[model samples]
Target: MAGWIWRTAIGLAAIIAAGVASAQTFPAKAVHIFVPYPPGGGVDVLTRTLADVVSKNWGQSIVVENRPGAGGVIASQAIATAAPDGYTLIMVASGHATNPFLYPKLPYDTFTDFSPISLLASSPNVLLVRSDSPFKTVADIITAAKTKPGGLSYGHAGNGTSTHLAGALLNSLARIDLNAIPYKGGAPAINDLLGGQIPMSFNNGPESVGQLQAGTVRALAVTTATRAPFLPNVPSMSETVPDYDTEVWWGLLGPGGMPADLVAKISGDFVAALNTDAVKERLGKLGAIPIGSAPAAFVAKIRADYDKWEPIIKAAGMKAE
Candidate 1:
């Protein structure tokens, strides 16, 4: 009996030691990052940039795979089913938090099926109108909508997206009934807005910054609680509707059951990459603020955001289309 007990204890200790060694020597091979959006979008750009920085520091190849479809469900499903090792990861956006309320059934659990690594960055969604539009300010749009409930229409990247939710929040907080028009993506929505096909759109910073800088589209307000530094002149929606605030964020996640030590290492490394000068400059130019929070903090943020948006999405009857 004593011999049997000793052997079992030795085996258990060996397993734990092996896990610690594996975490210390993580990234034995190239790492693959799955991006839910296509290349050149804000998420893709941020993922690739971080990949480059982290790869250089770790001396390992980091690859980004674009799997854009079904509002990021495709990539998310892939990541949730991947091995819990630190090699496979996904770059998730704010849509991840609200997806549960939007879709009746998901292949994997949003909280249990994945491990939160770190929040990469966040950016404010801008409320924009064509330069030639008659509505000059947020008050003008609100007043117009009050005059004709559900008469004025606004476009968004898609239903249940952060952009869409921003517009919906506007309707709720401002007590207006502006009809929401969904587009396949932000680019198409911006195009239609430019063509006057839609009166206004809630676009992310990367989508609207170039046009806003060129004076092609007029930004009435940002969705964050405070004004976005990139557009200091524009007021925040909170200013008009007290306490109204919404912002889109991107983060990293791995499959559930990842070793805690491995999770900490990855989070620390990614956060370090985000703090680099070159990466900071690029993110600033992209109108994003880098936030490299701890894994637990990131998980808490996801839960908090999910709670905040679930009721809004449910009330609006938003669903995956």
Candidate 2:
């Protein structure tokens, strides 16, 4: 019995020691982080900024690859099937949570195929209209829509995107039927708004800032529980309609089945990078708030967001385009 107990203890110690060693020596080579959007978008820029800082600190190169297609599924599948090593990671946007509901068939399991590392940042989607438009606030839009249900229309980037979800949530919470016009992307949607083709738009901060600064568009409100720091003067939708909150968020993830020790180490490194002044300043200019949540917290966030949007997507019949 003593011999057997001793052998069992030795085996357990070996396993723990191996995990520790792997965590400590990780990234001996370059690491790759896949971005689901094309280069120059918010997700790509954010990923590259963080990767630059993290790679310097670790003395290893972090390569960012953009695999934009099918609303991030192609890139997501890359991470889902990659080896469980920490080297293979992905920077996913809010679509990561809602994709499962939007697409009937996905090559990878949304929740089980990848391990969430940390929620890096979140940005509000602004409710925008032309500077000279009659609608001045959320209440005005709601009243107008209620008076002539489905008479008013708003444009968004695409179906199942955070911007689209923002409009859908407003419609549900406010109990008004505003026509939702889907655009190929936010840029064209904003172009139409400026050209008087669309009355209003639900656009992210990065895309809206240029027009807002140019005095061509006015922000009615932001889609968040609280006012965005970048747009402090604008009210949050929640203030007008209780419990209305949605934002564009991005997070880091690796293939499932990663070692707990390695996961902790990688998450800690990214979180530390997110805390640095350099990262905070850069992201702030882009209208993003750094979160740097723990692994468990990130997991909870992903699941919560998934649950929150699933019913809304289903009821609206939103599908990937």
* Per-model TM values vs. the true structure: 0.97, 0.95
Model 1, span 227-290: residue lDDT tens: 9988899999988899899999999999998888899999999999999999999999989989
Clashes of 1: 0
Off by over 4 Å in 1: 1-11
1-321: candidate 2 lDDT, tens digit per residue: 999999999999998898788899998999999998888889998999999999999999999999998899999998999998898899999899889888889999998999889998999999999999999999999999999999999999998899999999998889989899999889999999989998999999888877888999999999999999999999999999999999999999999988898999999999999999999998888889999998899899889999999889998888899
Give me the displacement of residue 11 in model 1, in angstroms.
Answer: 4.6
lDDT of candidate 2 at residue 261, scale 0 to 100: 89
Q: Scored by Cα lDDT, where does model 1 land?
A: 0.92
